[model samples]
Target: MKHTGFRIAVIGAGAIGQTFAESLLQGSIGEIAFMDLREKPDFLSDERYGRLTSIHELVAWRPNVVVECAGHNAVTTIVPSVLREGFDVVLSSVGALANPKIRTALCSSAVAGGSQLVPIAGAVGGIDALSAAARSGLTEVMYTGRKPPRAWSGTAAAQEVNLDTLTSQKVIFAGTAQEAALKYPANANVAAAIAIHGLGFEKTRVTLIADPAIRLNCHEIYAKSRSGELRVNMSNEPSPGNPRTSWLAALSLQQTVLNKVLGAQWAA
Candidate 1:
């Protein structure tokens, strides 16, 4: 690596960003700049990093790598500029890539700057094999995401069923990845990631289930191609502080940063 202690910038000082900053410091990353709208948390006040409230300053910082813990709005507003400035970007909000226009623009920026825009697996896995299956000719890709009804309160699932008093499992949404991303923005990242990797967003099948019986967030990836078939199921605990984010999503950011700085091998 050209930079021994990689200089990095973290967007969104929320749960995921704070976790990544702590991991980067413990890892080989020399100095990290944490950016967010609010002050650093009581637990995260340290001297090895910088803090900022504006996403606009990222262009001037010119970090070696930028890890995005922020949501889709940050992806649309901040990521493109970072990519245009020839910096690598690791994104946790994979669902935002469902917007083909943003995907197109980001791809163009990465190509023009000769940088890479990497999407973290977040709460789901098997993207490495799914992408390979796509190249080998994919046949079927099934993505099933099951979260408690409370988790789906803000999504369309609430309107379809009584999330508060659901006696059994209920299907909130069943359609393509595009529809899932559009209807369920919170769960879109994982669903959209599967779609973009296996088949284009329009072709990837998605089923979102809200089950009252399950307390943990669960995700399943079933993919088949000419080469073979792969299935993996993951259950993640919700972030203690932020109920909306899964624990693994934050860990994905940490692991990705570790791999970049400490040369740790990470799954794609």
Candidate 2:
């Protein structure tokens, strides 16, 4: 693919960010830049790529779209500001919006700048069907997230279940998507995405499990609506650079960016 003179700015130098950037570069899609506090990596040493230090610098670079791959804090603190600057933001940390205040801020900021805040369907599918079903009135939406014991480390799940010695699956949490996202921000972004597409956070049921037998991150969604009933199951490999993140999440972000640059309509 030839470079289209389109530019994309990514926020974060972490696993997902680097993966998405490398994919864009390999595809020869467009110019790319990184807005991160950390020093630039050697892979981005080419003159065409940029390492920016602040949102002001990002705005000056004039990227056509900004992708946020950073964690929840960045979504709350940085994404709204970027949107307020009239930049369409592709959000990977959808779990952050589980907080009503943060969600409201993002919405208001996007409206203020006449921009859109788009959330990628991370690590899972059937979002389009769910969204359509929602329009016809959804009665139930349930999400079950299962991952290896090691992947649940450092989160509240560690306190709920013994991740080290567990020989079988253990139910760590059962609650609404809002509570699940807030409690397990790093692991429950898919739950939040499903909630946003199928049902509101309060109505979406979420269950998180830590399994010793599964090496992959697994997601199961069951929804019922006036239109029909939907069920989806996905087992995704962990990102090589980060066990806590699904590799498919990075690819989803790259696809979202490509769709934006190519002016392709993406299913919500």
Scanning candidate 2 in windows of ten residues, the lowest lDDT window is: 259-268
Candidate 1 has its poorest 10 consecutive residues by lDDT at 259-268
How well is each residue in 1-268 modelled by candidate 1, as lDDT tens digits? 3335457888877777777666666655667887765566664467666875565676676676888877888888888877888888999888888888989989998998888998887888788878887898998888999888888867677677888888999888889998888677667688888887888789889998888898899999998899999998998997765656688888887777667765522322
61 Cα displacement, candidate 1 (Å): 3.2
- For each candidate, what is the lDDT? 0.80, 0.90
Best by lDDT: 2
Per-residue CA lDDT of model 2 for 160-260, tens digit only, reads 77789998899999999999999999999999999999788999999998988898999999999998899999999999888887999999999988888
Cα lDDT for residue 51, model 1?
72
Candidate 2 whole-model C-alpha lDDT, 0 to 1: 0.90
lDDT of 1: 0.80
